[model samples]
Target: MLLAHDDEGSGPAVVLLHAGVADRRMWDAITPALAHTFRVIRPDLRGFGETPMPAEEYADADDVDALLASLGVTDAAVVGSSFGGRVAMELAMLHPARVSSLVLLCAAYRGLEPTESVRTFGAEEDRLLEAGDVGGAVDLNVRTFLGPEAGVAARELLTQMQRRAFDVQIAADQAVPGPAPRRVEVDPTAIAVPTLTVSGAHDLDHFRSVARHLAEQIPGAEHVELEWAGHLPAMERPDAVLALLLDVLRDDPTVHAP
Candidate 1:
């Protein structure tokens, strides 16, 4: 099924894949600017926003490919945040012809052993959900994902997005019970596109490690660590992230200083 998405502007295509705790709306702060220079496509992945959870087996990479195909886009630069970053890599590896470049923001890597902090966060989130404390779960995510640089508005926005995602996912779980979908681990060494992995110093060690691993494994991949960010730097400091994105997306070797 084609994912629900917003396609704006008219230039080279650029797709923004959101984090697990967020929907396409997470890109709202910078989409307008990006739209002026490129065709920006932001999709609500299944079980996250307007898209419903799949009733049958499906891969998110395939879903994204389908969405791009429907838009007549043969290839595009892709940016993914957090869990979205994993999906971005999957797309590049599985559908190499579809991706022109990749930018991963505190991305999650499949098969990476979770750090103690990450495990603790996951367990608490599960406990909250199992206890029917959806609000608490949302709060947990806001606290865990947002950095010190994040302002009140960012925190509130994350709270709303996380709450919405939980509502959609929880309702879907009640309607369809099954094991988690299988994921195909990406072979980073085979990725040939210009790739950049951005990590936040304040993020969990697991994600930082994943960023480094991707940079090392993916030939020609560049890694940048943001000193003032957490797991979700885009939300924490949209303008700064936007500037960074503009520099990289322009594909000017001299523009990307950091």
Candidate 2:
């Protein structure tokens, strides 16, 4: 299936990948800023957004590589959030030459065996969604995904994201699907490219822990913890996120000093 993408700007390529349940549209607010300095390619992941599900059973890395190749992108800096972060990690590990640097935001990497609190929250969310209580699920997700101190403005964005996720789920339900494969293994040490791992202060403890783990395991990976954000720092604090991303790309030895 061809991935739906939005491309803007005109400089070295910087690909943006969104989280699960959300589409490439999630990057809307942040793209304009990045567009001033770099070319951005944002694509909806398979089974989410406007992208059609692939006819073949493939891992996220495969989709990512295929998309990059389609764009004639031999190398680019990748910025991924949540599920997209996992794919970015895979890409860095499996095809190091294709990535100049990596930035992960509230990424899911360690595995599915999250802490009890996260598990409980996820279970409740799943139950609510499965029982057709989409509104309830969205409410819970906002509280779970955003920091308590997030501004009123951020809350509105959270609502928009929730609505988008619900629509994505509807699309997923209408498509032919099969059992997804288990999570793929990522060898952080194998990711030799410059990397940055970002975690929201209000994000699930599991995510924070994973970020720390990634920093330690990935060779020379930098870690940034945003004090007033949660699972989606890019959405809640786009300006700050963009600043850090640009700084990293500019200062990273692999990218700028090379």
Candidate 3:
């Protein structure tokens, strides 16, 4: 499947991966600027945004690689946030030649158990699901996942995008969507591409820990923390994120200030 993607501009390709909380629309704030310098491609992951769910078990890493192939892109820089980051890492791990570099933003790896707080939040979401209030679950996510500094507009954006995700996901799962399919665990040491990891200081400890761990594990991966941002720093500060991408694209050797 084409996966309902937006591909624009020209030059080296740069794929924008969205967080679980929001779909490809989350990159709307940054895409225009990126498109000016690179071919920006953003896709709605399966059962999110404009993409339909797979009939059988599917691998997100495969979906991404297929998308790029359909576009005749052999290799490109992949930028992913949160859930999208996991896909990015796996792609680099499983198909190292396909990814020129990776920009992991608050990304978590598979097989790692959820943090206590995340589990608590999941339980709360389950309760909302039991109550048949998907909107309530969305509200819970926006409050927890976004930075406390998020304003009314940011909250509104999250609410709309998250609700859309719920609708798509629920519609796809007639029966229980089975437990996660087994994955090939990622070894950060194996990823040799020039990599950068971005974390928001205001994000949950679990995510910050993932960021720190990835930075430590990946050889020479530079780490940057957005002091006032949260889990979705691109949404919180698109200008700074754009600048970071530009620096990487230009192969600037200067690491971001800690």
Best by lDDT: 1
TM-score of each: 0.96, 0.88, 0.93
lDDT of 3 by residue, 86-120 (tens): 98998897778889999999997754567998789
Better of 1 and 3 by TM-score: 1
| Better candidate by TM-score, 1 or 2 | 1
Pairs of residues clashing in candidate 1: none
Higher-ranked by lDDT: 1 or 3: 1
How does candidate 3 score on lDDT? 0.85
Whichever of 2 and 3 has more lDDT, that candidate is 3
> Which lDDT value does model 3 have at 171?
68
Writing each residue's lDDT as its tens digit, candidate 1 over 147-189 gives 8999998888888888988987787777656325558778999
For every model shown, the clashing-pair count is 0, 0, 0
lDDT of 1: 0.90
**What does the lDDT read for residue 219 in candidate 2?**
90
Q: After the best TM-score superposition of candidate 2, give how far the Cα of residue 222 lies from its true spot, in angstroms.
A: 1.7
Candidate 2 error regions (>4 Å): 149-153, 170-182, 252-258
List the candidate 3 regions with Cα displacement exceeding 4 Å: 176-182
TM-score of 1: 0.96
Count steric clashes of candidate 3. 0
